[model samples]
Target: MAITKEEVLHVARLARLELNDAEVERFQGQLSAILEAVGKVAELDLSDVPPTSHPLEVSNAWGEDVPHTSLTQDEAFANAPERDDDHFRVPPA
Candidate 1:
């Protein structure tokens, strides 16, 4: 989990970053600590835990689908600035 100075510089190069000596040293320690913290997960006993996409139980909150009365063609075209019979008219692409 100990990130090397060379690894830090390599990462900075990949990210198109120009890190000074101080920044490189700082990031090296920070990245090492982060990796050590993340490595703790491997030590956990997760055999009894089920694999899930989400940590919490979730369900779709959708309302019942029902048919309803719709506007007529005349009503739909009433506010149109330009119309072409049954469709709204638009400028040619």
Candidate 2:
């Protein structure tokens, strides 16, 4: 399918883009080529193909969940630039 200059202008206007005459002409050709390629893909016969979410078969690759000891309050706040009692202090937002 060919994309018209008017359609490109309309889309640019909807997107709040200010395209010059040259840009509009350039995008019209580029978009038309992209649409033509997509149309070619749509014309392919894929009746026997199954819809796949991924190109490769991927199973859960996560490691076993194991509980571990976390840093203590004092240890966690040791590198804080500013601290009050036991917590790190931050500048007012």
Q: Report lDDT per candidate.
A: 0.92, 0.91
The residue ranges of model 2 lying beyond 4 angstroms of the native Cα positions read 46-93
Q: Model 1, poorest ten-residue lDDT window?
A: 49-58
For model 2, residues 1-93, the per-residue Cα lDDT tens digits are 989999999999999999999999999999999999878966889898887778878878688789889999889888998989887899986
Best by TM-score: 1
Could you give candidate 1's per-residue lDDT for residues 10-91 as a string of tens digits?
Answer: 9999999999999999999999999999899879998997767776677886778997899999999999989999999989
What residue pairs are clashing in model 2? none
Task: Work out how many backbone clashes candidate 2 has.
Answer: 0
- Candidate 1 local Cα displacement, residue 69, angstroms: 28
Name the candidate that leads on lDDT. 1
What value of lDDT does candidate 1 attain over all alpha carbons?
0.92
